[model samples]
Target: MSSETDSSLPTVAVFGLGIIGSRCADQLLNQGYHVKTWNRTPKERADSESDPISAAEGADYLAFYLKDGIALREVFSSIQNQLKPSQTVLNHSTVDLETTKWLAEQCEEIGCSFLDAPFTGSKVAAGQGALVYYVGGDSEVLESARQVLEITSKEIKPLGPVGSATVVKIATNLISASTVQALAEALAITNAYGIQPEVLTESVASNASGSVLASMKLPTMAIGDYDTHFSLENMLKDSRFALQLAGDAGLETPGIQATSAAMEAQCKKGHAHLDFSALFKAYDTA
Candidate 1:
């Protein structure tokens, strides 16, 4: 285990060096924090010499952009013995509430703090340090992570304790998925009616019902550019997370269910690695 520094600057350990994780680490570095990072695969680590346990050793804050619940559990197990009392763990992964709460309880048992701080916005937002954070944790811990959160996020909104951030993240995913499906349907409808996609998008985007998603995706749809900023696989995972949350709450989410089906169809067509906006292809080709 690494030793904590006496310097006034905060020390952080970041796991999962994916697009978002890399951006967060970069932001922390810019803010003059000593950020140690790790990834599941050696090549995925920003610096291969840094192992997960060693990266987390002696860190004041442990941050993660985990791939899934299983990955988070694996990391927690690996570092369980090394974590110090009062050390804060910020989970930025979009996962189920049950899992988040379970992890928080586990951390609490070890005398550490856990915060569910899932994010909104994509690589672009992360690169610009303009992402939004939905924070769920004790008020004091949330406040303590505020400076570090501000380094990588433009806004951090507390939604209550423990599992609340996951709840909000699920809602956000539902809205995003719904928006993509809506855009796909609208573009397909306009094309069938012989109305140009550019024209329809322009008119709708200026109206109340138009969303940031519609505008952002319109240009790409017009030219059929569906490159990956956020992959369909990840979107599908989030949709599943949302559906699972609804099931746990004993609520029905018909729209999310429909969106999940559409996304699965796109995935079946082998577009899982493509941008989520590629869902448009399903409707466009029909």
Candidate 2:
């Protein structure tokens, strides 16, 4: 579906102008959507409102790209009364399953449609309109929001129902966190044994165990380039959410548990804002 809104496009209120949100909003605007934006911390942009309510009013779609469940609930509460049945609320933030359900309920009560649409893809992908959305909600509602979503995503995957997308997002993050940790450990062990980091990187690339995560992270980790594509703190938060999901199902997630612990330690060392690949910093002998 290709579109250019000009002034006729449905107005979309974008909350939370973080790494992904900021880029998405810009893309939406460039694509001809009437985009209103708000961030908890004020951002200096003409389209950004000073508060959530101001941003949401008169908008046909209220899209959240917030930090976590707490921020999502807080902003949602402030604007719930303003929501009408005619408006569609799309949550693009990766939040806990509990919050995903709660948001659905809140929207239900307000008689407005909602989509549990947490997405995968970080700064670069978002900027390039390549994020893949894991959508879980009413099929009709998804159709209504599809254009706005398509503006930011290369793929719009409908998983099941509300809360399912959140679970999948958290579950995938667990794999990503654990993979980086494994890469870090492998690099450390190889370096300790007098083998170069690049050798292990190459070996992993050809090995069945190799993945896109390994390819993207290993090169940067080798050079200690922890520039933030996705932050360690955010990954840590998602890992804990993954643990919660496992615990609820009476499952033992020892691997993610250990990776979560490592992330926690790294957060304490004040590396929370760095790229999640900074997990390698744990083995940084230099």
Candidate 3:
């Protein structure tokens, strides 16, 4: 909220340099934190290298925006011994509640406190430093890391214990994936009848049917401008995870089932690397 961040800014080591991670490093640097980055894949920046051990050694905060819990475990397990107990490990991956709890267990075993802090927003939100983080950890630990996190978040919701953030993340993503599926199908059906999608999208925007996601993706979907934002592969994995979560809770989730099936169909068609919005191509755009 303040232009001035807390005085206790720590040197942050960012692991994983994907769309979200790179944008995080940029914002951290913008906030004047001493930022060093390491990707599993090497980069040429002076502060970035391929070595995780060296990167983990010097920083007071280890921030990860990795693909999943397995990747998080492998990277940290390799260097967990070297990490100081005082350092905080921030996991920004959108994973299941169990995975989040399990990773937190591992971090605790190695004497480092862990924060399961998954996020929302795409590359655009990340680059603009407007990402929203759903953090599941102690209030004291959250404030301890708040200065470093503020570089990239509009809100840092401390949603109770270690698995809470991930639970929220998966639920929110289920909504997003289901919306994308419905919106894309509507566009496809309209096109099949030779009606312009522009009319449908415009009308939807004015009525109760409009959504933040539809507005963002609909224009691009109409023109087939499917530059990668969130990929189809990630969307499928997220949808399946949500459905699995619902099943685990002894609840039936028919909507998530349909959502997962649509995503699987899209991924099977070899559009996995493209944006999740590329569900537009999964339709009968033929």
Candidate 4:
């Protein structure tokens, strides 16, 4: 039915209107794709549907950008029997590996193709349509979804079948959490020694250890500006998923383990909803 609007573009139904989903939905609409959107709490948007089933009806691509595996599963179950074999489902949330595989299996049971397509990039990237997707699915399924995917991504890196992207995403988040924790410790040490926070930030930027993440996060952390590009709680959830993967392989990841502990402390102190760089707040009292 959506093809009636534009024969070339498939109708896309986007679930979740959190930071990334909301922006991506806007991008799809702006690009002339017929988009149906739904958020659990309901948002005042013209494209928003009253229920998940309504949003998904007759959709060619059903994209989920939910908070966690729990939310994803709940919504998918509500619409599972209604799904047609012609539809392709994309999971863009970074959730546990078990959940990722579960989603794939469920889709297969209904004869619908599924893609484990969690992504990287935060609120700003979503707004700019520059998110990078780490996709895991059959190449043909990917090609079928490419045009809609490209509406919100700068690049699509296809890794392999069904669950690879989720693994890569969790591993990458472990590094990010550890890196921010290290940056927080370094900033606290330098500031205690009569060194300016900005100086340390500049030094890191010029050092071999510098990164795009540091450049963007360091200055903000220095001033206690944790403005939620990605929430501390979301990063904490991903870190735990990483630990689970490592533990299953009989490996110890002390760095992310310690960082997860720090994030938990910050979350207890009521900073969970802030940007993940709020890890620095753990040292604000020290």
Q: What's the ranking of the predictions by TM-score, best on top?
A: 2, 4, 3, 1
Task: State how far residue 267 of model 1 sits from its true place (Å).
Answer: 1.5
The TM-score between candidate 1 and the true structure equals 0.93
TM-score of every candidate relative to the true structure: 0.93, 0.97, 0.93, 0.97
Location of the lowest summed lDDT over 10 successive residues in candidate 2: 1-10
For residues 1-286, write the lDDT of model 4, one tens digit per residue: 1223455678999999999999999888888788899999999999899999999999999999999999999999999989999999999999899999999999989999999999999999999899999999999999988988998999999999888999999999998999998898998899889899889889998999899999888899888888899999999999999999999999998988999999998999999999999999977763
Model 4: residue 154 alpha-carbon error in angstroms: 0.6
Higher-scoring candidate on lDDT, 2 or 3: 2
- Off by more than 4 A, model 1: 1-7, 44-50
Whole-model Cα lDDT of every candidate shown, in order: 0.84, 0.92, 0.83, 0.92
Better of 1 and 4 by lDDT: 4
lDDT value for candidate 4? 0.92
| Arranged by lDDT, best first | 2, 4, 1, 3
lDDT of 3 by residue, 99-190 (tens): 78777887788787789899998899999898999999988889988877888989888898888888889999998988988898898888
What local lDDT does model 4 show for residue 221? 87
Which lDDT value does model 1 have at 196?
Answer: 88
For all predictions, the C-alpha RMSD in Å is: 3.4, 1.8, 2.7, 2.4
